[model samples]
Target: MKRQLVEELKSRMKLLQEREKSHTAELSHLEHKVKVLTEEASNRRALVDSLKRRLAVASREKSQQEAACLGLRQDLEKKSQRVEALQARVSASERSQSQLEQTATRQLEGLAQQSSLALDALQGRLTQQSSLALDALQGRLGLATKQLEQLTSFTKALASEVLVEVQEVRSELCRKRKRKRLEEVGDVGLKKSSVSRAQAVAASILNMTPTDLLHMLDTPPDTEEASTEDSRRDQEWLEQVMAILQQQIPAAGRLMEAVRVKMKERKVLTEELAALTAPVSEKA
Candidate 1:
C-alpha cells in the first residue's frame, strides 16, 4: 500500500510540472501579443495626429481662399459700378453731340437759303442792267455808223472834185503849150495871165473862185492820204471803243454766268441733301 501511494504521488508531480510548463509558454505568447498591440496603437495615434495637422492646414487654406474670393467679389462690384457710370456718361455725351450737330445743320441750311435768295435777286438786277446797257450801246453804235457813212461819202465827193479840177488845169496847160508851139503865137496876155482860163473854168464847175481853185491846185495831191489818215484815226477810235465795250460786256456776262452756275450748284446741293435725308425723313 505505501508503494502504491508513492507511485500515485510521482504521477501527480509529473502532471503538475507539465501543466506549469504549458502555462509559462502561454504567458510568453500573450506577452508577445501585447507588445504587437502596443506598437500598432502607437502607429495609429501618430496617423491620427498627422490627420489633425492636415485638417488644420486645409481649414486655414480654405479661409484664405474665402478671403481672396471676397476681395475679388468686392473688386468686381466696384468695377461694375464704374462701368455703369462710364456708360451713363457716354450716353449723356452722345445726346449733347447729337443736339449740337442738329443745331449746326439747321444754321447751315438757313444760311444757304439766305445766300441763294440774295444771289437770285442780284442776278435779276444784273440782267436788267445789262439789257438796258446793251440797248443804249446799240443805239450809240448805230448813230456812230451813220455819221461815219456820211463823212466817208463827203470825203469821196471832195476828193473827186479836186481830181477833176486838177485834170482840167493840166489839160488846159497842155493845150496852151501846143498852141504856142504849133501856131507860133506870142502874146503878152498869155504870159501875164498866171491864173489861166482853165482855172476859171474849173472854179466855175467846182462852184468856187479862181483864187480858191489856184490855192487848191497848190496843195499836194496827198490831201487824199491825209483825209484817209483822219478817217483811219476815227476808225481806230471806234475800234478802241468797241474793244472796251466787248471787254465790259464779257465781264458782265461772265459775272451773270458765274451767278447762274452758283445757283445750279446750289440746286444740285439741295437735291443731294434731299436725297441724303430721305430715309431719315421717312423713318421720322
Candidate 2:
C-alpha cells in the first residue's frame, strides 16, 4: 500500500506542472492585445488636434474679409455724398448762367438804343449848323450889294467934280489968248505986270488935275465908325458859334460819363456772377 500511495502523488505533480505552463502562455497573449489598443487611441487624438487648427485658420480669414468689405462700404458712402454736392453745384451754376445771359442781352439792347439816340442828337446839331451857315452866306451877299451901291454913288460924284474943273480951265485959257492977241496988235495999252498976273492964274488953273480931286472924294467920312461896325458884327458871330460849341461839349461829356458808368456796373455784375457760379471744391 505504501508503493501505491507514492505512484499517485507522482501523477498529481505532473498534471499540476502542465496546467501552470498553459496559464503562462495565455497571460503573454493578453498583454500583446492591450499594447495594440493603446497605439490606436494615440492616433485618433492627433487627428482631432489637426482638425481644430484648420478651423481656427478658416475663421481668421473670414474675419479679415468682413473688415475689408466694411471699409469699402464706408468709402462708397463718402463718394456718394461728394457726388451729390457736385450735382447741386452744377445745377446752381446753370441757373446763374441763364440769368446772366438774359441780363447781358437786355443791357446790350439798352446801350444800342442810347447810341442811336446820341447819333440822332448829333444829326440835329449838324442840321442846325448848316442852316446857320446858309443864313450867314445870305447876309454877306446883301452887304456886298450895299457896298456896290455906295461905290456907284462915289463914282458919280467924282465925275461931276471932273467936269466942273475942266469947264473952268477952258474959260481961263480963252481969256489968256484974247489978251495976248490984243497986246500983239497994239490996240490998247496993256501993262506988263497985269499980263504976268493973268498968265500965272491960267497956269494955276491948268495944274488943278482931275486925279487929285477924285482922291480927295474917295476918302471915307467916318473911318472909325466903319471899323467899329465890322468889329461888332464879328464879335456877334463869334459869340453865337461859341455858345453852340459850349452846349454840345457838355452834352458829349455827359454821354461819355453815362457810358462809363454803365460799363462799370456791367463789370461788377459779371464778377459777382462768376464768383457765385464757381465750384467750392473738386468732385470725387
In candidate 2, clashing pairs total 0
Q: Pairing residues by index, what is the TM-score of model 1? A: 0.33
Which predicted model would earn the best lDDT? 1
The deviation in Å at residue 230 for candidate 1 is 83
Candidate 2 lDDT over residue span 1-284, tens digit each: 97888888878887877877777777777777777777777777777777788778878888888898888899899989999999999999999999999999999999999999999999999899989998999999899877766754553344334333433443344344344444453446667677556556655676754444433333345644754764564455434433433452334454344435434544654554444334322211
TM-score for each candidate, following the candidate numbering: 0.33, 0.24
The local distance difference test score of each candidate is: 0.68, 0.61
lDDT tens digits by residue: candidate 1, 1-284: 99999999999999999999999999999999999999999999999999999999999999999999999999999999999999999999999999999999999999999999999999999999999999999999999878766754564454345434434544444344344332232243454344377678899999999877865665457755855774565455444433433452335454344335434534654555555456446756
Model 2, position 176: C-alpha lDDT score: 42
Candidate 2 weakest ten by summed lDDT: 275-284
Per-prediction tally of clashes:
0, 0
